[model samples]
Target: MSLYQLVYYSRNAIAGDASVFEAEVDAILAASRRNNEAAGITGALLFNAGVFAQVLEGPLAAVEATFERIQQDERHGDVSLLALEPIAQRSFSNWAMGFVGHSAENAQRFAAIGLTRGFDPARLGGHKMHAILRDLTLEEEAAAA
Candidate 1:
C-alpha cells in the first residue's frame, strides 16, 4: 500500500469547550474511521490542541481522494493542509483511523506550543516534537468504545 503524510492546522474553535469538544471529537474520529475503511485507508491522527497532523496509508488514489473530501468538510472548515505527499513508511498499519494524544512532555520537547506561529510545509517540527500515540492498538480503541 502507498502512504501519504498529511498535516493541517485547525482553529481553536475546533475544540470549543469540554463536553462539546468530547462529543465532536468522538463523532469526527468515528467518521474518519468509516471514511478510511471505505477508501481502504489506515492512519493515525495526532492533535496538539488545535493543529492536526496525520499519516494515511492506502492506494495513492484513495488517499488523495479522501484528502480532497476532507478539504471540503464543514466540521473543520478551517482545515488547511500544510503537506500532502508520498511517504516511505506506514506509521499506522493496524488502525483504520486513530486519534491519539501526544503527551505533554513530548509536546514540550521540540518546540513550545503557543510560541510556534505560522504553519510551514517544510516545518514538520510537531511530529518531531512528540512521541506518537501509535502504541494504542485496536484493542485499546475497542476498550474505549
Candidate 2:
C-alpha cells in the first residue's frame, strides 16, 4: 500500500461552554479512534479553543476518504489543507488517533514555536505542524506511561 500523509487545520466551530466543549472533543476523539482504526489510519490531533491541527497518515485512498468526511463535519469550519503527499512511512503509526489538548505545558511549548498570541495553525507550514504534533503527542504518551 502506498502511504500518504495529510496535514490540515480548522477553526473551532463547536459552540458551547467549557464543559460542553470538553465533552464535544471527547466525543470527537472517540469517534475518530474507532473510524481511524478501522480504516488503518494513524495520526495526532492538536486542539485549543481557537484552532485544530491534525496529521493523518495511511493508505492514499483511506486518507482521502477520511479527510472528505472531516470536511463535511459540522464541528469544523474554515478547514484548510496544509499538505497532502505520499510518504515513506507513518509518523504516528502507534496511534489510531492520539489527542493533545492545550494544557499549560503544551501552550508553553507552542509559544516556543514562535506564536505569541495563541496557537495559530494558519501561520505554520505542514511539515512544521506535523513535527510539533509528533513531539507533543510523544510527550503526552510518555507522561501517561
User: Quick one: best lDDT, which candidate?
Assistant: 2
Q: Per-prediction count of colliding residue pairs?
A: 0, 0
Compose the digit string of candidate 2's lDDT tens values, residues 1-145: 8999999999888888889889999999999999999999999998865888899999999999999999998987999999999999889988999998877777777777764456567678899999989998898888889
RMSD per model, one decimal: 5.1, 1.4
Best by TM-score: 2
Off by over 4 Å in 2: 115-119
| Candidate models: Cα lDDT each | 0.62, 0.89
State candidate 1's TM-score.
0.65
**TM of each candidate vs. truth:** 0.65, 0.93
Once fitted onto the true fold, the runs of candidate 1 whose alpha carbons sit more than 4 angstroms away are 1-3, 102-122, 125-145
Compute the lDDT for candidate 2: 0.89
lDDT of 1 at 32: 88
